[model samples]
Target: MLPAMIDIGVNLTDKRFADDREAVIERAREAGVSRLILTGTSLECSERALALCERFEGQLYFTAGVHPHHASEFGADSQRALESLAAHPACVAIGETGLDFCRNFSTPAEQTAAFERQLELACSTGLPLFLHEREAHSRQLDMLRACRDDFERAVAHCFTGTREELYGYLDLDLHIGITGWICDERRGAHLLPLLRDIPPGRLLLETDAPYLTPRDLRPKPKSGRNEPAYLPHIARRVASETGETEAALRARVLANSEAFFGL
Candidate 1:
């Protein structure tokens, strides 16, 4: 039997899963993905994520914060809402929050302000941070470093960055999350060598579902919607790249997720 694995990041709140979220989750369980941490990218989604966590109980958990893409939506009321959400027993972290300069969906100023506020929220709630970053790693790291001593823990979710950025995050002792992006032979080729750079205990695995479908899946799903069930495929690829047995990688990542998220 495959050992249990936790998908540290999944957007179960996405509209794509609306038709059959429960079925998707069941499929994940059968595929050995035993726990999931739903990501909240906005206020509404954060609330919805928490509700889903409550419904699924032990099998589902969630992060509460606004994404940098939606940073414009962050305002005076945002902190109050996030704080209330973070107080929930099912809310395991404070984010989906950080800078995303790759696409200026939200102004840089808005993104930075929102990111800082969420960092403060993480410190206030004493919850781990589930962070996101793109081309804005340098600035994100600056802000994170400023308050890094305050938060209990933090992970850079869906990391797809360069070696310098990866090492920068590692230098700060931040945890790194790997997604199916590593499966792509085109853009992800560089990540193959960087896998060995991550320290054993700081690496975490995720699907970032309804997005980043693993490109190498055989008989790939027609919908092209990634799910926790496909996590093993990503894991197999990581093991291959890092020169470790799939079983060993799975065990190590599972332990990392448990420790990082207090699972």
Candidate 2:
């Protein structure tokens, strides 16, 4: 039997998959992706994600927090709303939240405020965190360090950062979620050398589907749309880069995901 794998993050709520979400999920199952945690980037998306999780039951889970890009939308009712959503059994984490200076889609002040609020939510909810970070690593690390003790767990999702940044996160005891970004030849080259630094139990894998499709995929999907089905493809590349066999890497990541998300 194929080794089971869990995709720690997938944006199934994206409109691109609206027409055939069920079929997309079925393909993931055939690919040996046994579980998927759909990412929720906004309040509306969070609600939609939860609904999908309910529809899919044991096969789908979701995170409940605002992304930095929508930080400005976090309002007086945002915390209460997120907290309420988090109460659901299917709500697995408290974020896709953090700072992203690469594109100030939201002002730094808004992003910081929103990130801190979500950190508090994680602390209160006792749920793990699904975090994001771009060019604002320094500030992001500082905030996370200050609040790390309060939260149970956290991961830097879709990580593609500097060596110093990687060590900083690891020092904070944050798990690392690697996406297909590692398969990119131009921008992802630096990560190949750094993979060895991730301790055995701290590494997790995700597809961040419909976004960072592995460039190395043979006969790449004609639609150019990524889905959870490609996680094994990403895993194969990770194994090649890290000098571990594919089965071993898949087993390690699956175990890491189970512990990190309490699956």
Candidate 3:
């Protein structure tokens, strides 16, 4: 049997899973994905994720914050709501928050503002950060560095950047989350070499579900919606690159997830 694993990031609250979230979790359970941290990108999403966590009990936990795309809507009310949610037992982290300069769904300035506030919340709540960064590593790193000493912990969720970006996060003593992105030959090939760069305790695993389904999954799920069950596939790819057996990789990744998230 495969080693038990933890999917440290999952969008279980996404409407895509509305009809079959329980079935999705059951598949993950059968695949040996022992636990999940649902990603919350907004107040509505965060509330839903928390409700799902309560429904699923010990199997689920969630992060609470606003994503950069919705950064424009962030303000006093958002911060207050997130602060309230962060107090919940099921709320395990303080984000889905960070900068995303790729599309600028929210402008750089707005994204930065929202990210900074979420950083404050993380410190205040004593919860680790669940971060997102796409083409804004330098700015996000700068902001993180500024308050690195204040926050307890953080993870670069769904890291798909370059070696330099990976090094930047490692330098901050931050945990790194790998997803099915590494299973894709086109965009994720560069990540293969960087896998070994992430030392043991700092590496985490995730699916970023409803997104980033491993490109090569045979007979892909008919819905084409990613979920926690495929984490073992991502682990297999990581093991191949790192020259560790999938069993060993899963054990180490599970340890890292437990340590980072207190799972």
Candidate 4:
């Protein structure tokens, strides 16, 4: 039997998959991606992800929290709703949360306030955090340092940063979620060297589907849409960087992902 794999991140609710989301999950199954955790970028998206998990039940799960991009819209009601969502059996983590200063889609102040609030949610719910950080790692690290002991655990999702940032996250005992970004010959080259530094059981894999498609993917999807189905393609590349066989990588990540998200 093919080794089972878990995709720790997937944006299955993105409009790109609107027409055929079920088929996408089926494709992931055929690819040996036996499980997936759909990301919740906003209150609405979190609800949508949870609904999808219900449909897929045993094979799928979701995280509940706001993405930094929507920090401005995150209000008191948003926190209340997320608290409710986080209580669901299908909700495995407390984010799609963290800081994103690269675009400043939301002001730094808004992002910081929202992030700290979600940190409390993770603390209260006793759920791990699915965190995102871009260009604002210094400040994010400062905040996490201040509150790290409160939350159980967190994964630095879609990490594609400097060695300092990688080590900083590692210092805090954060799991690293590597994605297809490591496949990009230009921007992802740096991540290849950092792979071996991730301690065993601290490395997780994600597709971040419909977002960071492995830039070198063969016969790339006609729609240019990434999905869980292509995860194994990414595994082969990650394995090369870490000096492990693909099966070994898959088995290691399966155990790590489950424990990280309480799956």
Task: Give the whole-model CA lDDT for all candidates, comma-separated.
Answer: 0.92, 0.94, 0.91, 0.92
Clashing pairs in 2: none
User: Cα miss at 39, model 4 (Å)?
Assistant: 0.2
| Structural similarity to truth (TM-score) of each candidate | 0.98, 0.99, 0.98, 0.98
Better-scoring candidate (TM-score), 2 or 3:
2
Model 1, residue pairs in steric clash: none
Which pairs clash in model 4?
A: none
Native-to-model Cα distance after best TM-score fit, residue 120 in candidate 4, in Å: 0.3
Give the alpha carbon lDDT tens digit for every residue of 1-263 in model 4: 65899999999999999999989999999999989999999999999999988888999999998999999999879889999999999999988999998999999999999999999999988999999998999999999999888999999999999999999999999999999999999899988989999999899999999988888998888888899989999999989888999999888888898898888
Whole-model lDDT for model 1 versus the true structure?
Answer: 0.92
Q: Give the least accurate 10-residue stretch of model 4, judged by summed lDDT.
A: 1-10
Sequence-dependent TM-score of model 3: 0.98
Off by over 4 Å in 4: none
Give per-residue lDDT, candidate 1, residue 55: 93
lDDT of 2 at 172: 95
Candidate 2: Cα lDDT at 227:
93
What CA RMSD would candidate 2 show? 0.7
Off by over 4 Å in 3: none
